[model samples]
Target: PTPAAPHREQAAWWAVVGWLGLLLQVLLRVIRGAPSSLAKLLRSLGLRHPLLSAAPAVAFVQLPSKAPADDLPPLSPPPGRLTVVLDLDETLVCAYESSSLPATVRTQAVEAGLHCFDMEGISSDKDAKGRQRVNHVTVFERPGLHEFLQKTSEFADLILFTAGLEGLSCRTFILLSIKSPVSN
Candidate 1:
């Protein structure tokens, strides 16, 4: 009777191990090949499976080289006006904080069509003390800016680009429009 009891206990343990092995095998097979729906779900969430990482890298198309200048036909002038891109900061106008403006600049301001005005409600910058500082900006236009813009506009479409903040750029545009007849 004792020998029979030992054999039964060993058999029960083997049965439990067999069932566990079968369950693990089924789980592994499911993971190895995910369902189409699961793959779509992963794609929607911008995720890639490990198997995709093992695939070859994508090939890129090669663009044709540009033709040499000598090989191209003689070019005629465009029927429409040409386009001109102008830089605003130093080319058209120079702006500086009121407190930092030089004495020499102040003397030439009148001749250069300098416009001094206070910009309010613009608290985008901070000072050395970490407090918001909205100081007055003084703009000095180039000596022949109006004449240059006028001449360029007659033969080209003018586009202005500025490195200044939006508020400053808008203010400069307004000032230029108000002062220059060519801006109209």
Candidate 2:
């Protein structure tokens, strides 16, 4: 056979595999009601209507049940100090854009020992015209935050977690560590 024939055969084989995969997916969707996204994708490809008519109905088999294990050991409390994971945004402190903060929050922030600093060199925030603007974040510590950290440190190791940007997290860590009396 010519080299072209082999290439054609391989292409035909892949086409068959692709169709089989599509058919199996269709069968699964029929067995379980199709998800909206999957239904949309099928419709977009013009395969939904044809597959619905051409595909064979698939039956799902029930899985065999297993006996519960009675020899498992009873759960025991942790041996050492418990670990406490705290979220940074609302739990330990609240960070806000300096320009939009309310008067009450600004006052409380002052009372709570707020940390205000300008963040430049990065364009994360957008202005009304959609141009990127540098961020100026003001972070306000929660009431009794220092005392809470001190007390918690005696019985537990605290971990600060945040969903904010990397720079914010680094700044938060540095600022809190500088203010915190607790030793590593």
Candidate 3:
């Protein structure tokens, strides 16, 4: 019986294909400047080989930029809560000063029924949210940050002054059970 040669050539070709695929994907990310399905797909493949893992060393995908939306529920802060203009980032949770909550925040907001911004940060300018103006922000809240939220909601209006994506922010706030009473 003829000896069967190991599938070395086939394996080598597959590796090459994988590498090219990874390279093209990297280019696409550079052009788009954000994470894409391909990256996640590759990660899910569960390949542990160094060759597969090191195919693309550079991460070109840019994290999606969070921005406010047009349909935000009209805000109605507490009538006499003392508009404190509290910060939601590191000032409270003490992390990136841009991420939201430590899961603790969610709990506190839920318990207190306190409203909070998911992605809060200073816009590039006051009019950044305008159609012609770009909404810009520089901070975010932390995860499990109910403890942090408890401190702020205790005494302030807690308006989110950020350029983050409104939907994302609202979703987080809602999940936290943060609700505002409609008041005059």
TM-score versus the correct structure, for each prediction: 0.47, 0.45, 0.24
lDDT of 1 by residue, 49-119 (tens): 65433344687898768877888998897789778888888788877787787778687767566644544
Could you give candidate 3's per-residue lDDT for residues 1-184 as a string of tens digits?
3344457767888999999999977776553454456545666887443433435767697865764677468889767766555443344322223233366755665577543443433433446456433332222334435564566667654554423345434443454434332111
CA lDDT of every candidate: 0.71, 0.71, 0.48
> Compared with the true structure, what per-residue lDDT tens digits does model 2 show for residues 43-92?
67786564444345786898757645775577798789778887877778
What TM-score would you give candidate 2 relative to the actual structure? 0.45
* Regions more than 4 Å wrong, model 3: 1-80, 87-144, 177-184
Better of 1 and 3 by lDDT: 1
Ranking by lDDT: 1, 2, 3
Using TM-score, rank the candidates from best to worst. Answer: 1, 2, 3
Alpha-carbon lDDT of model 1: 0.71
- The better candidate by lDDT, 2 or 3, is 2
The candidate that wins on lDDT is 1
Consecutive 10-residue window with the lowest summed lDDT within model 1: 114-123
The weakest ten consecutive residues by lDDT in model 3 span 175-184
